[model samples]
Structure formats: C-alpha cells, structure tokens
Target: MPVIVAASALLFSSASLAHQLKSSVTTVLFNKRTHNIELMHRFYLHDTEHAIEHIVGKQADMLNSKSDQLQFADYVAQHVAIKTPESESIKLKNVGFEVDGKFFWVYQEAPMPAEPLSGLQMSHGALQELWPTQVNMVNIEGQGKVRTVYFDQQNQWHTVTF
Candidate 1:
C-alpha cells in the first residue's frame, strides 16, 4: 500500500509542471522625450533557465551570473526584431536584464520613427525552436492607446497601428 501511494505521488508530482506552458509577455512603450521605443519582456525564470541551458549549454542562474544575464539579453535581441512602416529594419539596443523572484525581465530600446506615427511591425521569435507550443504576447502602449499581439511559430510578425 505504501509503495502504491509513493508511485502515485511520483506520477503526479509538481516536477511534471516544469514545462507546462511556454509563453512570455512583452510591453513596448514609446518614449516621446527620448525619441526611443522602450521594451520590457517578462518571462518565467524557471522556463528561461531551461531554455538558456538548452541553447548555450549552461544553466544561467540569471540572478547570480552577470555573464548569464548578458547572454540572455543577447539571445532575446537576436530573436526579436522591429521594422519601420516602410519595411526598413530597426535596430533594437539591449539595455539590460534582471531577475525578480520567479520572473525574469529584459530591457530593450529602438529609435523612434522619424516620420509620422502610423504603424510598426514587430516579430517575436523567442523560444519557438526549443518549445513547439511557445507563444509570445506583446503589448504596445503609445498615443494614449494599448494593443495586444500574439506571436507563435506561424504568426510571428504583427503590424500595429496607432
């Protein structure tokens, strides 16, 4: 009876929820004063650690290791991209990264549009290779409006107009 109970406990353990969902959320803000678009991406720390280990072959305890945090920032910068309304690519400058308990945050910035503020295209390609079910949600906040967009393997890019 004890053995049966132990087996059941192991089968339905909390460890099973390690990779239950692969998702991240990002918020983009247009800084009119700085003429830059600031980005903040929030992710589950556990999932991000696993992903870093898979990609870089090192478990990055983001809170403890500066190099690991930099690596994560680089990884995020590579996977995500921005484009102007005219289809020209915009360079995203990675500001930094931080660990807040169970969540990890990455900071980024890009040059604001030189012309009128019509629309912008953003592509979020993080974790798609490692996790097939990965979905990234991005929120754009500017001009007294907010919009949400989802990014998956199939739908990676979204053009948001304000």
Candidate 2:
C-alpha cells in the first residue's frame, strides 16, 4: 500500500523531470556562405513558440505599438540557447532578420563535411521555406553561387535567380 503509492509518486516525478529536460523548439540556422542549414533543438524544457508568443503579446500590450513585433525577435536571442539536432550544445554568435515572421539565425562556424567526400545536402527544401518572404539572391560561401526558386502563398513558382 504505502510502497505502491511511493513508487507511483517517484515514477510521476521522474517523468515530469524528463519532459522538462527535453527541448521544445527546433531552431534552424542558415549559413549562406557554407550553403548549409544547422538545425538545433533548444532544451530549455519549454515550448519556444509559446514563450515567444507570450512575451511578444505582453510587450505589445504594454507598449501599445505595432512596432513591438520586433520584440519577439529580441526575446528569442536573449533567452534561447542553440542546441544541435542531437541535443548537443552549440554557440550562436548572431541571429539576424526575421523573414516572413520567422527568425533567421546565423552561427559562428561554417559547416564542415560530415563525411569525407560526400557533398553537403539538405533532405528537404527547408532553406527556401524557412523564410516565407521572397528571396532575390542566395550566395553561398566556398560553394559560389546557388540558385533559388520563389513561390507565392498560392504555391505558384515564378521567380528563379542565381
């Protein structure tokens, strides 16, 4: 009876703690120079979107200004820590513009080839989709010029630039 209750309590506590340890936000940093996107998961144990929304909403209300939209951008950089896809630690030096309402991030280091000769590639077209706004040009470091195709909200692909 007592032992059973104690065991249940312990299990519940551990489960709660484990949930708290996992990251809530998956941050993808784009390096135009290296032509690689570094995906990171922030392990602050809370949902990143919720936090941003809450902070930004509060700030907007307080300021009563439309310009407060940029507050969320500032909050992310101040509170969020960069983590790798595997939940490893990473250091982000700068986080730049928020394109199409999503923040664009930059890292201190250029990406190195994980495998010896295999070329770097992204599994998905995340780079293009990361920023919802139209991109005019994409210049990758070391890799020279890269091509990009832009589509509108209607999914119509019209523009292509190198």
Candidate 3:
C-alpha cells in the first residue's frame, strides 16, 4: 500500500512537469467577388512567444517588441505558400498581424487564378521547427466544400479540390 502511494505521487509529479500540447489553426477561404484567397492564422500567444524565443533568442518577446512581432510574421510568410491548379505559385500579400487577448492572427491574401481551380495546394509549415510535437491545423473553406488537414513532422501541405 505504501509503495503504491509513493509510485502514484511520483507519477503525478512527473506528469505536472510535462510540456503541454502545442497547436495552431490556419483558415483559408476564397472570395468570389475579389478573386482572392484570404488566409487567417490563429495561434496562442503564450506558445507563440515561447516559439519565437526558442527560434531566435531567449530575450525575444512578441507582445512587447515590435521587431519580434514582425519577425514572427515574416516567419509565417516564409513558411506558407499557395499554388494554383495550374501549378503556379500565387503571390501572397501579408497585409498585417494582430494580437487580440490571448491569441494572435496573421492576415494574408493571394489573387485567385484566372482559371477555375481543378485543385489547390497550400503549404503551411508553422511551429514545427520550434517544437517537434507541434501540430498545425489547416482548414480550407469556400464554394460548397470545407476541408481540414493536420501538419506534423511528417505533414506539410494541404491539397484538395472543389
């Protein structure tokens, strides 16, 4: 009985020190009128700041430092890429990013192809470098279809058709 109690205490203490799960969600949507695909990426501020510090330096701070925030956004722009059905990469305009409460959002828009999509390819590789257990969730919504994909060490791009 004493041994069981001691083992349970050790298990609980070990679990308490384990790192929490890390995740982010990216949403892609197409606007018919504007002929552009809009992207919104949401990430928890705590994890994001931690990631920035991990990649750049320990002193880096996203919420307090303007350069840190821009650097983080630039990191997002570099990792994400969009390709049309014709296999041509679309130009992405990183409009801006914002920190609202506990989360941050990065906005981007890419001009849609002149021809209708036979298929779309989006490569979103965020946070995987910072943490091996990071999971990047991407959801594409537009037309009549909505699709979701998860990115880990083995996953990168999310490709689907309407």
Candidate 4:
C-alpha cells in the first residue's frame, strides 16, 4: 500500500512539471490617454489551447484558439473603444509579444491628426503631428530612457529608442 502511494505521488509530481512546461505568459498594456488596451500572447511551439487553459483558466482556450490570420490589431482597437475610457483619445503604442525570445507585432503609435483646417489657418503653420512617428518621444516619468529590446522582422533583437 505504501509503494502504491509513493508511485501516485511521483506520477502527480511529473504531471505538475509537465503542465508547467507547456504554459506561456501574456502581458497586457493599458494606456489611459489613448484609451487603448494591448495584449501580447506568448506561446511555445508545442503549447496549445489546452495548455493555455491550464495556465490562465478556462477563458484562455477561447483566446488562444484564435487564428494567426485574425486581425488582432483591429480587434484590439475595437475592443478598446468598446471598453471606453475617461480620456477622448489614447494611443496604443509599441504593442509587442514575445515567445521563447521571439517578438511579434512591434507596432508604434501613429501621429495625432491635425486640428481643424480653420484652426490650422489661424495659428502658426505647425502640423498637429509634428513629433516623431515612434513611441514615447518625450521623456516623461523617466520610463522612456530604459529601452526594451525587441526582435525585428529579420529575427534580430534590436534596442529601439523610445
């Protein structure tokens, strides 16, 4: 009877390790100014919806099952709009996901639209979107200086200046 109990303990331990090996990490970023919520789904090659379900509960299966061709960017944009925020416009900048050190969706926020034509004509000739097309050009809160290394399309990890 003791032998049988020991074997069961071993089996359970191995199963727990196996479960841990198949899980992934997801990072979500929410910007209050732009009212944007970005999600990054990171998974290993052998990992599946079942594994994701085990890690993040039952709701994981529904999200992990989404096809690669699905428009995640548009979906995120729409999802942000539906959730709504106190701010008028919040930009989703630098949405990225990493799987085994591989990065995906290195998107940067687009420039803000110009003011009305009448306003533009009255003021100094300055384009509303004059700042850089990249993310976090201004160093506010000191977080912008600490650059995050992300893998480019060429599979090379580059330190991008924000």
Candidate 5:
C-alpha cells in the first residue's frame, strides 16, 4: 500500500542519519598461563577512520593503510597508562593492531605486576580529545570479580583495588 511504502522510506532515511555509538571498550586481563597482563581495545571502525583523518589533517584510508592503523595504535598507547600501587609505571608493550569486520583492535601486553593488584591507576583517552561525547569503558578481568571503569571527558583517570 502507499502508506506502507512511505513508512519504509522514512525508516530508511532515519537509519542513514543515525550515528555510531561513539564508544570504545578496553579489557585488561591477567593471563594465568603466561603470567602476563593483556590489554585489548576495540573501537568502531567508522569512528577510527574519522578520528585518524582529523588528527592527520587529511583524508585517511584506515581500512587499507597498515601504517595509518599502526600510527593510531601508537597514539592509543601514548594516551593510556597503568601504574602500580607504589606509583611505578607498568610498561605495556604494544603488541599490534588490526581491523576486523566493523571494529579496529589494538593489543598490548606486559608481565603481570607483582601480585595483589591494589590501588592500580589507569587512564584511557584514545579518542576523547576529538570527541567530547566519546566514552571509553575498561573492564578488568582475571581478578576474582570483574570490575569496570568508564572514562570520559570529565573522568579521565580511575583507581581500582583488587
């Protein structure tokens, strides 16, 4: 019917204008087998492409450009931090990054810090500089109960005791 066709057109138009979630998820997990702390970060591919263009001051081909992806991975590493209870930096080595489906992933790993992860300080500011509304959620696992922390424009750092 004419009414059904009009409704379908409206829905398709609205969907085209819908924005992405503007969020990223990072998970910090302790590997029991390797005794290492592994960090995995996932960001919406669309967001990353725009962000890279904004930072690079030119159009970026994130999907096909390996160097661009690696550059973004390095930028992410510089923006995040993890420190011990004693305020010692827990250096996380950049493992790698890759685009998988609709998501871009970055990986980092380091030897698990001395046990009893108490007063661990963490920060994630990957894309917040560009998008004020962006939210980065970090989930800590392999530490008894999974704890979650959210970082945004206002709250950049968090201390977690486990």
Candidate 6:
C-alpha cells in the first residue's frame, strides 16, 4: 500500500511539472493623436524561451541574446494579423521586443486607415502550433471602450468592433 501511494504521488508530481500555462495577452490601442494602431503582446518568459529554442532548432538564449529575441519576434509577427472588414490587410510594422521580469513583450504598430472602420479581424497563432493548448487574447481599446477577442488552436480569426 505504501509503495502504491508513493508511486501515485510521484506520478501526480510529474504531471504537475509537465503542465505549464500556455497563454498570451495582447493590447491593441488606437492612438487617435498619432493615427496609429499600436499592439503590445505579453507572454511568459519561460514559454517564449522554450518556443524560441524549438522554432530555431537549437538552444535559444532569450535572456542574453538579442538575435534570439528578434528571431522569436519575427516568428510572432508572422503569426499575427489585423485586417479590415473588407479583408484589406493592416500592415503591422514590428516596433520591438523586450523582457521585463517574468514576462516578454512584443510591440507592433500600423497606420490607421484614413476612412472610418466599423470592425477589424484579428488572428494570433504565435505558439499554438507547438502547444495546441496555447490561448491568445487580444484586447482592443478605442472610441472610449474596449473590445476583446480570443484565439486558440481551433479558432483562428476573431472580429472586434471599435
């Protein structure tokens, strides 16, 4: 009985260690003054490190290596998109990326459309391929209110209105 109990405890402990929270949050702000849509994505530092290593097929030093961070940022940029209701792409330019404490952030921005927009479609799949349980949430702030959209392994595109 003791042996069985010990084995069960070990199993549970191993499972707990293997499970990590796979999630990311992005804030999209429409700066009317600048006429730009700014995006800031926040992710777990540990997860980003592992993902960078897996994506580059080598050990990635995300904390100390700027190249690794840039590579990961590029990967993130390729997996994210913001489009208009008419399917016109909103060209998002990579602003930069940085690590702050236990989190890593990727920044992007695009010029706002000259015409008024009713809604925007967004897609985020940065780490979903590697970890199917990964969930990405985007909060868009504009016009004195905030709209939210979520993405996961199953659902890719979500539309939000300003």
Question: Candidate 4: lDDT over CA atoms?
Answer: 0.32
Task: Output the worst ten-in-a-row residue range by lDDT, candidate 3.
Answer: 14-23
State the number of backbone clashes in model 5: 0
User: lDDT per model, in order?
Assistant: 0.87, 0.36, 0.83, 0.32, 0.89, 0.91
Clash number for candidate 6: 0
What does the lDDT come to for candidate 6? 0.91
lDDT tens digits, residue span 5-34, model 3: 999999988766543768889888888878
Estimate, for each residue in 8-125, the C-alpha lDDT of model 6 and write its tens digit. 9999998776557799999999888889999999998899999998998999888999999999899999999999988999999999999999889999999999898888998999
lDDT of 1 by residue, 47-91 (tens): 788888898996567678888777877888899998877788888
Q: What is the C-alpha RMSD of each candidate to the true structure, in Å?
A: 4.1, 16.5, 3.9, 16.3, 2.4, 3.9
Clashing pairs in 1: none
- Candidate 6's displacement at residue 116, Å, is 1.4
lDDT of 2 by residue, 1-162 (tens): 999999999999998876544222333435555655444422221232334445555423212323342453444344333333344444444434323223323223335335322122211122123234312222222333443322223333222211
Tell me, by lDDT, which candidate is best.
Answer: 6
Q: State which candidate has the highest TM-score.
A: 5
What does the lDDT read for residue 40 in candidate 4? 48
Ranking by lDDT: 6, 5, 1, 3, 2, 4
Question: Could you tell me which residue pairs clash in candidate 4?
Answer: 33-90, 34-89, 34-90, 34-91, 35-90
- Comparison by lDDT, 2 against 3, better one: 3
Residue-by-residue lDDT tens digits, candidate 5, 23-103 = 899999988988998999999889889998888887888899998898889889998999987788999999999999989
